[model samples]
Target: MSFDHEQRRPADYAAYGSDIDAGLQAHMRRVYNTMCIGLGITGLTAYVVASVPALASVILTPPLFYVVAFAPLAFLWFGFSPQRIQRMSAGEATRMFAIFSGIMGLSMATLFLVFTHESIARVFFITAGTFAATSLYGYTTKRDLTKMGSFLFMGFMGIFFASLINMFFHSAAVHFAVSVIGVVVFTGLAAWDTQYIKESYRYNAMDDSANARLAITGALRMYLNFINLFQSLLSLLGDRR
Candidate 1:
């Protein structure tokens, strides 16, 4: 039942390698499917809210926009904290994920008013193509991605903190630089996360509860990467309406 590195067969990949491999593939598929469904909900919600002048006007205004802008971060801390979410039951995870995406959709609804629909669509497809290809590389490649994990985590934090500062500075060049870095970091993260998730699969005998939670964790990680990638590309490349 131990996932300890010393205990698990690092070389053998467990005795039932084929069965475990097949199970891992299925697990990864479920992770991806869950992430995509969450994204669909976010996108649909954003479009619906944005299309309605009343809703958009109410939500996109100052105090309300601030709440929307901050809601996802709050969700990350209060609801989806790493320690908390890793132990969450399937139903709890699903509900929390749905709520997080809903809040994000509300926050992002302003994009519809700010950018041309054509540009938003273009950036979305671009982000999707890039994420899919990079994630595939992570899943299929032989090279270990663990080495890149720490570096990418640092880059992610740098982007996040820099964003706070840029809120006031509002320098176009600084914004552009961060946007470019944001895309690169998130893309690399998507690949790394995919590989990590694939390699971290445990035996069914080992705690079924933890194994199930792993899929939810993987979906959340990949979803964050996709959302960040889309937002960064949209900021840099999307045309204003």
Candidate 2:
């Protein structure tokens, strides 16, 4: 959440504008590549756990399952806080991301149990396409998305609270509304976050350590958007097993 906005040297930019642009492109690719790797980890872990009956029974069953379900939240609170992230080395951040992705897979294994694999795959591709287009717009468009990001973040919090309430109420109508709003909110967030990350790179371009940490955080933001969008779309479109 806390990014160092150390401005790049004006002389350096004037002298090597092309080089700076190339660095920005490479930085964005690094962000996307890390996100894809995290997704791969999550997908593989989810499939392996879901395919094993014994493993599923032990981890996805009852009282112990809550531990798995909430472990990512605990990790975010204690390990991946802004303060902790600021202090982490590149290697440490990478390990944290891998561990978080695996935990997320365990939490989401129920998706495989509830929905047909074909529909899950279909929804994932749809989410990916939408993410790509929105992110491209964010990167290329002249319009500033900072204010939109703030508004969408508020909507995101409202959706979060509504989801928590619906978990207790178990209302079909609320769930439906939340799913629709979640899809919209996450879609917009994908663009906002992409623009935010792109802009941040301009400021932190000179520092390797800052850039390394920024890439991880940027990837984390985009990865969350993709996951939430995919889940929302799956809730609306996936065929139940």
* 81-174 per-residue lDDT for model 1 (tens digits): 7578777897798788888888888888888889999999999999999999999999999998898999999999999999989988998998
Query: In candidate 2, which residue pairs get closer than 3 Å at backbone N, Cα or C atoms, i.e. clash?
Result: none
Residue 224's lDDT in candidate 1? 91
What's the lDDT for all of these models?
0.87, 0.90
Q: How close is candidate 2 to the true structure, as a TM-score?
A: 0.93
C-alpha TM-scores of all predictions: 0.91, 0.93
Residue 85 accuracy (lDDT) in model 2: 70
Error of 2 at 38 (Å): 0.3
Model 1 residue 212 lDDT?
76
Q: Count the backbone clashes (under 3 Å) in each candidate.
A: 0, 0
